[model samples]
Target: MQLIKLCDFRQPFSLNDVGCGYGALLAFLAKRHRGAKVDYLGTDLSQAMIDQAKPSPRPSMRSQFVVTGDIPRVADYSVASGIFNVKLNQPTVRWTLFIQQTLAGMHAASRLGFAVNFLAPPGPDMQAIPELYRVSPDVWASHCERQFGAKVELIEGYGMREFTLLVRR
Candidate 1:
């Protein structure tokens, strides 16, 4: 969330990190923004992941998961990272449908929309990944723009050709 820190998070917020593998990033951001004291919710299909979560020596502020099928539970100004890249091995339609559902959940709570990442065209993270619904960063940009009615703002990272898009509606 280094890039996110560089942006405007001035709005009062609650963030949802969907499919949060192990709450590493969620804990980091929650800790980092402790002064703001925003409510942060992180969800993963695996209960083991959440059980293992340890928020380093912070106040009572923390991360927890709402059930998957319940999207309206998350609050506004939500964020998600690396949603699509991990689901590469699933059927395209299935994964895309999942994307829609996930966004719908986030949108149900988000007033500012969500943020995500994808490798640049030709897929920087393509290798060793199951090639299910893999597509270029541009395609993902268009898809989000079309689907979410938001502009896809892209930033090329320090060491990789891949780009991060912070989309807002």
Candidate 2:
């Protein structure tokens, strides 16, 4: 909440949730922004995930969404609540390109800010790390700032491991 307010994403704002696997954040934001009309859009490469996303309390609470395709070039705020760390079967170059391109999408769309979360990779003793990408926040931020030229302020350990980028407009 503080992050949202700090970024000034009150009601009537537009949020683009990239790689929205289950739309949890979308639903949560919809509920939070219910006081006012906010455009909550979720996009993902997988339709199964969207189908699996739990429904909002009401029809109105549901987040508007589309399957992977051409998305916003720029938006008020771009959210990757739990995306950006997915593992892929492509080569390292492809993986790097995918990350860069996705971030580019957020950069183009976000007018005020872009927020993402990459939980730290489990340790050797951990049982499982279900996520695809598991890079540290600082490493991710380095790549992000290098490409986007945005001033990066990293806030970690708020809940799980999260990365919020207050992109320069």
Candidate 3:
């Protein structure tokens, strides 16, 4: 939810929840932002995930869930959480390219801004996990600033070994 704080809730807005597993964000908004008007669209690549999300209690009549890897329409804001963490056996170069392209897509889909979280590099004492994709925050912050001409804000040290990039256009 902290990642979505980049959005303004004082008025009605539309949101695209990329990789919205089981529509968890919708439930969070339903409970926490009951008075705020939100038109929510949840997208995931897995059909089973969409099926799981469809039966969940909806926050509003405007909410919809779809099985897709891309955002279907422009929205006021877009958010992706824990989407870039697991790389499995994908090579670093390919994974990095995928992240860059996904970020570009998110920037294009969002009108106000977009936010995404990534795992931070492992501590010196901890053995690096090959399956987990982690990097210094500056790598993507610089990309958002230069590639999208966005005003990027890095949110970190919130009691997690991760950081979120809030890219505002």
How high is the CA lDDT of each candidate model? 0.63, 0.65, 0.91
Question: Per-residue lDDT tens digits of candidate 2, residues 103-129?
Answer: 787788888767666657666776655
lDDT of 1 by residue, 65-123 (tens): 54453544646656666666666457778887877777666656677666766545444
Better model by lDDT: candidate 2 vs candidate 3:
3
Model 2 spans > 4 angstroms off: 1-7, 52-63, 121-131, 159-164
Query: Which residue pairs does candidate 1 place in steric collision?
Result: none
Q: What is the lDDT of residue 36 in candidate 1?
A: 55
- Highest-lDDT candidate: 3
| Root mean square deviation (Cα) for candidate 1 | 3.3
lDDT, candidate 3, 1-169, per-residue tens: 6688888988899999999999889888887877778889999999888888853254452798999998999999999999999999999999999999999999999999999999999998989999999999999999999999999999999998999999999
Prediction 3 global C-alpha lDDT: 0.91
Question: What ranking of all candidate models by TM-score puts the best one first?
Answer: 3, 1, 2
lDDT of 1 at 17: 69
Cand. 1 Cα-lDDT:
0.63
Q: Which stretches of candidate 1 lie over 4 Å from their true place?
A: 2-7, 60-62, 67-69, 122-129
- Count clashes in each candidate, considering only residues at least 3 apart in sequence or on different chains: 0, 7, 0
